[model samples]
Target chain A: MNDFIRNLASDLLRLEINTIIKQNMSAEKIPSNKRVLLRKLADMYRETLIDYGIAKSADDPQLTAADAPKVLRWQFGGEFSFKEIALMASKGIEQLEQAIKNETDPLRLNVLNSRQKILQRICNQSYNVIGIFKLFRRDLAPDTLMQSNEHEEPAKQIHYVDKEHFNYLRYQRGELPLECIPFRSHQETAHWNNDLDWMHLNAADDLPFLPDMLAMIYKAYQIGTEQIVLQTVIQVEGDITSYITPQYINMPDNIKEVVMNVHNRAISLSTQFWNTLFSTVMNLAGKSFNQIFTRNRK
Target chain B: MTLHSIALLWKKTVNWTFVPVKGLQFARSLLKNGGHVVETSFVFGKASFTFKTVISFGDIVVFIPDPAGYYAQHQWHDLCQNPHWHACYQKYLQIHFEEIANYFHAIERQIAFWQNSISGFIGIVNIYPLYRALLLGEWFLLFFPIASALYIRFLGKVTARAIALQLWQIAKKWFIPKAALIAKILPKAG
Candidate 1:
């Protein structure tokens, strides 16, 4: 950690010097060679500054000690005081940093990098994991599932998985992550507007609606593009419906790229739809009002 | 001093309203005590500090809730929010979206970030460095263009909707060519 910070600081200092030179060069009459050297140095330095800050931040003893559990406790219900957790996290980070600084082997550096990743994950989880922790605090039947369709029983544990595992599971099914999928085909309760869905697709006018639609959906649902497999392009008119599933689409390359395009489209279409509504809703209402008033004038 | 008192002091000292001397000292003190002092506010001068304790780069952040400095720097942020003001010279997307699309775009980015981040924390990648880095990098990039896009998208959505509404109004007016009927349907263009 310390090594990373030191390196980062060095990098930042270099950048600062370069920036100073660049600004001066741009504004003042100066030697071109000197300016070029400064520019190069500055670029190098800028790259390292964030790393330096991260290193310096890690050097705080309390930061590393303050891991996810402490953060979870502190944030969920204020069960654990922040001051205490902050001190622990800071201290832990400091120790880790020291360990890295002391190590000489290249292999050890890899370990340090892995540790750094864990710390980062903890920090990121501090947000939603806190929410999950809050869920634990809720009073409910022990066996009850908060979101039932996804889980057969109340989750036994909020286990953390590696990214590889997550990717594997998601790729395996082309479905959103977690124990269960969230959506229920609400055809019985909700009106099946096959015409409307078709019209929405037609609005693209043979333009690749798939990519835009996928993008919009990805954004709307906040899932990875990979999570949604275009299973089948279903065309429905009147009572007859036909569609193609992923089983039919054969490709040598990874499917992730294909889905990303869909994700992009979904995002685009979803935004376009809502934007159309937001921009025009008021005017339509106003127009209706005018119509009533004009009739009175007649 | 009590921790609460220290935090208050730190907050007050952070302001540009305070002397530079005080700011320097405050940063130093926070570092000395193993606190990560983030210089997010630069309303006055260059904000920096030195670390006294050894902590990981990720560990040393002092997360304040609704830091006042951000509000103080609202004008600068407003520009950042509307990237087009500066981004146009930079040749980025500006003024070509429906208002709803923009709004949804922003919403979507935030949600995607959260999902990816949450998964990362849950050890979705098993705390692997490569995986974590990929996730972090993805999120870091979004801060700039994505945010700006979101704002632009919102404006575009609103403007497009308004235009569409106007067109609808015009069409409605013409459908019944009778002046009386037209007047009834079309509101006086205020």
Candidate 2:
């Protein structure tokens, strides 16, 4: 069963990769050779940056002492070393630069430039991984080891600070690592950043429905809130009914009469609304089916 | 019974019950983690003008037209007609371009995850009954190997439709107006 699930996930991932390739092809109309190269480069980057899990772990705040050594080992001796990945990315950037230099069409140039930018980002990330790993090693180094050495004095025990303090230290020292800067910039300028380089590239055409979809999500939240209110009302009504049931048995006749009347009125109103809603839904469904059949016949 | 037989029985029992439950738990976790992305895609596809009309006609007739096509069309029209609004809209898209791309990538990942997980679950469930039938020599049961297939498919469709409708309602109430506001507030291309 485990094997089956694994196979299924791999198959799905393969299908997704194909779909992305197709979408890029349709959207960009890149030459076949360049397309294949781009696809290969993308796959390589995805494997190194995403599939390896080290990059993500590097960003993890809760990384423990035990995991740090294992992660370091993976980074240095993993299937593709970070240096090799960085070299490949630089090679990819060189190719993209050559393409951009030769390409006459502004549109294709834009696409190539975007790809180059992405490759550059990957290259930077690869280099950052080494620095991040070094930091991890320094944090996790043992004080006892220094004391045991005959030539060395015992160093002060440095406790590992969380990500925030680490950033503060970097700031105090006037050292802004590439990884630290992007996240900080993102937080600071999240609301307003006018970078129109993507506009000429027609990047928005790739996902035209985005703005609308975002708007729809906002709308959905409002509707969902209202639905919750309606649902709560129904729930409260049910609770009232349940609560009144036991109390009704012990109540005096007049009080029972008043409670019954009120309960019946509430139930009647709710049922009426529900019945109308049900009927309207059925009507609409029937109409839609009829329209579909009629259109098919025509 | 011998200890070995007891162990074998235990293994079989766990495989029969525990494995599927774990698979379900995994699928549920995947959905819980990544469902919003998939839901957004679903909303984009199913929230057509016709769907909106039908829904609004049923309820209070909120009359929120489909925004996917509508927004794109209007943005183009606005860009053509007015230079100022065009500038603002371009800036808007550029400002949010990374975010939009991130969303697109996430949606794709969620879609791939969902398709594979659902197909995998269905395939496993279907295979289990056949395996059982073959092991027990239950020949009649072999005829109903995929008995639950149609039922599961129907349930999936119904759930998807229900979720889309609920999302549509919310989109109409909040997103449509916000989109309109953005359009209104941006300087016209005078």
Candidate 3:
């Protein structure tokens, strides 16, 4: 079961990376400096995933200033910039080339796939930093009132179940596993930090990175909803009367609004691209469930 | 997931990030992650900050923290480190003499909540640490999601254990023979 989820995690990461790569490629052809920046972003993604234990590779050549793809190749050959040559190369060429040369070990594949996903997150973070810098250029300055005394109001009480029935538990008291919380939170945190690093690079406020950052968030949301549905399906397939059954999952209406918001933002990215990705995700989800059903029958 | 699970996870996640830190560290941690801080002043004692939206001074503090990091200051702090009965009475901040004055502040923090399960309404409740001592059973019972359903299960276990320990407490209590037998039977049935 752990292996199943871990494999799914890798697949999900690859899918996420592919989506980001597709979107960026669609938005505009890679420019010289931007291509260098993208490779750097990819390197950052690779190193981060390795450190997190999500990816496992002892040696993937380090990216250095002078050792850049173009800089090293230029001395021996042509005068073309690295970005121009990269632009001329087919989409997903670098990742595909690496995938082909690498050994087909499940662990290695998982590592590369996870790196692919992390690169997507890095790109999203960069986009957010750039967007915020562009959008809130004026508000980038630090405000005078750094700290103040207005606290958040308590959440409004919603009467779905009585307080007597639906009692909340604190973490210390619960004997549940930490994996109960979605892995998406960690992914989001990683992406946010990546964006912060980019903001540091540009010496700009993190606020400008809002738009694309929001898009990445939307993509994650879409993936998360799909995950919940998949898990629910698996649980239901196991047993109809399990305590955490699909029938028991009463998703609130507000949650639906959040999903819609993510879908809407995704559409805003590029309608055609969003549609294609959405369809691909749905198809994969369908295939996953189909495999489960066939396995159960067997 | 059930409402109980959702609320439990929400409460835990907030506390996981917010409870530790003070002054600049708290402020930087919040803002660096796109969260803001609320400065709460008290009429007396030392000052403290908790999470994205909680500040504490004397008893008279401000409102609870919100999801968005819009921090607003609610009251002024009385900078008396020592508890002086004369000082609170002398300084007329409020109409009545309350033991403490805690202010509320709102700080705006940006969190991209991807889950459809997360509603903007985060319930804030006043928790008294003192109750933790007296109501050990109640506190223990309260910390389970779907407590109503789990409470019965907990009681069944407690009863079974009590039955096994029936003669165990006999030496301390010095109960009669019939009464001891009844105590053992009653727990087993439960």
Regions of model 1 farther than 4 Å from truth? A1-72, A75-253, A279-283, A292-298, B1-190
Local lDDT at A112 for model 3:
57
B-chain TM-score, candidate 2: 0.25
lDDT of 1 by residue, A152-221 (tens): 2437212222223333354256543332221112111112111111223233222111211222221211
Q: Which ten residues in a row have the lowest lDDT in candidate 2 chain B?
A: B52-61
Q: Write the per-residue lDDT of candidate 3 for residues B97-144, one digit (tens) a residue.
A: 121111101111101111111111110011121122112224342232
**Candidate 2, B80-176: lDDT as tens digits:** 4555533443343233333323433443433332232223223334454443443334546544433444444456645644654587689898999
**Which docking band does candidate 2 fall into?**
incorrect
Order by lDDT, highest first: 2, 1, 3
Of the true interface contacts, each candidate retains a share of: 0.01, 0.00, 0.00
- TM-score between model 1 and native: 0.17
Q: Write the per-residue lDDT of candidate 3 for residues A183-215, one digit (tens) a residue.
A: 111111121222222333344222223212333
User: Between candidates 1 and 3, which one is better according to TM-score?
Assistant: 3
RMSD of each: 29.5, 30.6, 30.8
Residue A282, candidate 1: C-alpha displacement in angstroms: 4.4
Winner on lDDT between 1 and 3 is 1
